[model samples]
Target: MPNLDDKNAIAFEFARICSLAAVKIMEIYKTDFESRGKDDKSPVTDADELAEEIILAELEKCLPGVPVLAEESFAAGFRPKTDGAFILVDPVDGTKEFINKNGEFTVNIALIENREPTAGCVFAPARERIFVGGDDAWAGTLKAGETVSPDALDPITTRARPSGGMTAVMSRSHADEKTLAFADAQGVVEKVSAGSSLKFCLVAEGSADVYPRFGPTKEWDTGAGHAVLNAAGGCVRMPDGAPFLYAKEEVEYLNGGFVAWGRID
Candidate 1:
């Protein structure tokens, strides 16, 4: 179990790693590349594999033996046991958005200990925005050709649920009737569509009140964003009102429905 100081340090490193992966993703995003389907029929591209390779290499150098469960790697049968502390990497979240050139994809990384994401970072290269949360939370922007650094970030936090009604952010690619119904039940005053983990970041920054994810998502898909939300005074929970957890070997890393709330009350 890492202490607060250790977790913060690791969180900073995770942000840097996500930034590097984001840069690689943006490079490929600007190219004329094609996507192919994975075994699960999810779209994957060279950017996903290339960015994951960069992130994995850096993780091995920075924290050797700390198990990493990355999207592309796991899809290729690299199932390393995550007994203690481990890293989760989604090299290019929102691949469909990326393929469509919607500029909603992101590079995600998280540090999980005891089945909880203690620290994480989400970087949207196309948008030049980075959101990090752990012992602290921050939102930052990157200029073209700029590198990521701690000094570039500004602290951010969640706001209380509005007195009127809450704003909700939903997935642009995966929105379905069930998700819309869930949002409607929450009394959402306004709805916004975004791709990738940015939905969680929006709630963390107080720009939105809640994000109900009724669609199927994997641990890597939400771990980093979950950490960010938690650090920013938010939480992600099961639809049945249980705390969301990670490293569920019994489920083969698949996550069920969840609600990420900016205000838990």
Candidate 2:
């Protein structure tokens, strides 16, 4: 088992890499950056490549020989060999938001140990905010100069308790019928729309209560936000209510259906 100190180091390094990537992403965001759509029709930008390269370089330096599975490098044919640990990276989680200049995008990084996310970080440069999660609680949304403020150390919330009516959040880009059906099954009173992992953050902060994702997504897309929710007294569970897991080879790094709730019961 990894010690608490080692876990903290992982969280810290993950945040550092995310912060560095945030700077690069913002640089490209401020200018006219070219955008293209991948085969899956998701938007990709220069910011993604620049940030991923920087993150990969830094992670290589800090965690030498550790395997990395990143969205940008996913095609490189590197696979986790079972037995040890690897890092998952999604340099820009909300590329569409970034491309549209909406500033909802983020840099996500997570360390997976024994196929579980032991530590993770999410940085939103446009908001000058960062969230980190690990064994010793977590932190969220530090202003530009403030460093390392610990998130409230409270018990994680398991499920959404109906308060008159529950809140539901869905992807602005990928909200599909199945996600809507799940939300309807919950009898939600209101629904909000957002892009990327910000949906997870919204649920974590209690701004929204639940987020149901039915469309396809990669492990890196949800890993850091899942860790943040876990730290912020919340959780991301499968439709059947099991906690989310990462780095499983069975699914080509793609995630199954999951629900993120402010409180899990």
Candidate 3:
């Protein structure tokens, strides 16, 4: 139930925070970035903490009443208020790629209502592109170089079917054995890897045919991408073919398995 007129303000504000976080990340990327480990053994960095700090602070100011579930702050015992809905934030996705200075990392933010994503935004700071969408609109993609009118915003679309030669997308830095097996099972003829939610965007824009993620991913990691893909005539489905839902009561907020596709023809 987010108003589109107001959504831009919120999205713009989040974008600013993300941009700031991206700058901090870039600063770290330029130098010998520090590293540490979470209990799950996933990597963490100064960039992640700094960006999360900035994003969390801004969310506090901008959306004071709404509860926030962020990746960096989740381990600190912050359980979401499942009574209704909330916002999910991955202040920095693709931390490994960020560390590699590949510029494919992104800031992902999504507004979940009643366990469904109503609006979301993704910013590729280094690439200077931003993607934003809501249920009422076909998500819009903006790059640093183009002039786009509001009316000229293009609607995203998924491929009608898996291309003649399936082009499967995997994580650039986080590819796992299960993903490799899934791609092989699907008989993928081409494989492309990208960092962050760009995997979803690739399928949305028809650049790739499918994204099968068998590895672990938190709700925040896919909420924004889910909205984008759904708007683009694609879907994120559980392994058993159910639609993905967020704000589940589970404490971990971890997703099981999902296959993103334009369609399964």
Candidate 4:
């Protein structure tokens, strides 16, 4: 039996699952599928549903009986028992980008334990890129419909803060006044735009310095990317420098304002 407590094994297995789901996502993406709004008015497509289904089935085999708070499943009112550690999944992280065919959308999965993400994977199908976090973080290319292997992946880490000003990455669509102000207050010299959890991957690979968001988000939306950033020598924290915790049942897994930095030091 696979060791569920082994983060490296978990990360790699989760990544393989994400890669498999991305193949189905890309297959539907190439079709003329329609997108519809959920009860919360968020966009969802067949790709999202099918991808989540694939992930869930694989999770049953890999880590049976572990509660999964998957976006599609939760939206469909299938709330599993999640009193203890659970898995968070966002089958399609950037629905707008997917709808627009911008190639920024991703499939995200993370193991959430004790209010922290222990391991995770983020796979962008259109971009053929995958990032995984275990005992460490790694980035690699995996073509849609291709099998995944960690041997080719390169270890990734965040860079030290630049001596000058920081390069801030913001949401391509979900920008808010608070996030803009935060960037300005930090004296950001350069700014980059990204959709979905790719902002976290950018920072994890040292391509950006920070990503700040003070707007609405769900635990599923950030868990995978947060794990990657954390394992890559970066971290996510409240603007006040407090730790970012998850499993907010009172808020239905809603996440508050937080910033992701390449390195706090």
lDDT (CA) per prediction: 0.88, 0.77, 0.75, 0.92
Model 1 stretches astray by more than 4 angstroms: 1-5, 143-145
Candidate 4 lDDT tens digits, 53-120: 99999999989989999999898888776668899999999999999999999999999998999899
Q: lDDT tens digits, residues 1-265, model 1? A: 2344566667777777877777668878889999999999999999999999989998888888889999999999999888788899999999998999988988899989999999998888889888888788888896434565667788888999899999999999888898889888888989999999999999999999999988799999999999999999999989989989999878778999999999987
Q: Rank the candidates by lDDT, best first.
A: 4, 1, 2, 3
lDDT of 4: 0.92
Which ten residues in a row are the worst by lDDT in model 3? 143-152
Q: Looking at candidate 4, what is the lDDT of residue 52? A: 95
TM-score of each: 0.95, 0.87, 0.85, 0.98
Give the per-residue lDDT of model 2 (tens digit) for 1-265.
2333477667777887787777778888899989998766777888898889999999888888888888877744656553478788999998889888887788898877766777788778887667777764444555332444444223233345677878998999889988888888898889999877878877766678899998788998988887777767777778887867776778788898899888756
Give me the overall lDDT of model 1. 0.88
State the lDDT at 84 in candidate 1.
Answer: 82
Q: Backbone clashes in each candidate structure, one number apiece?
A: 0, 10, 0, 0
At residue 61, candidate 2 shows an lDDT of: 86
| Segments in model 2 whose C-alpha atoms lie over 4 Å from true places | 1-5, 39-41, 80-83, 136-162
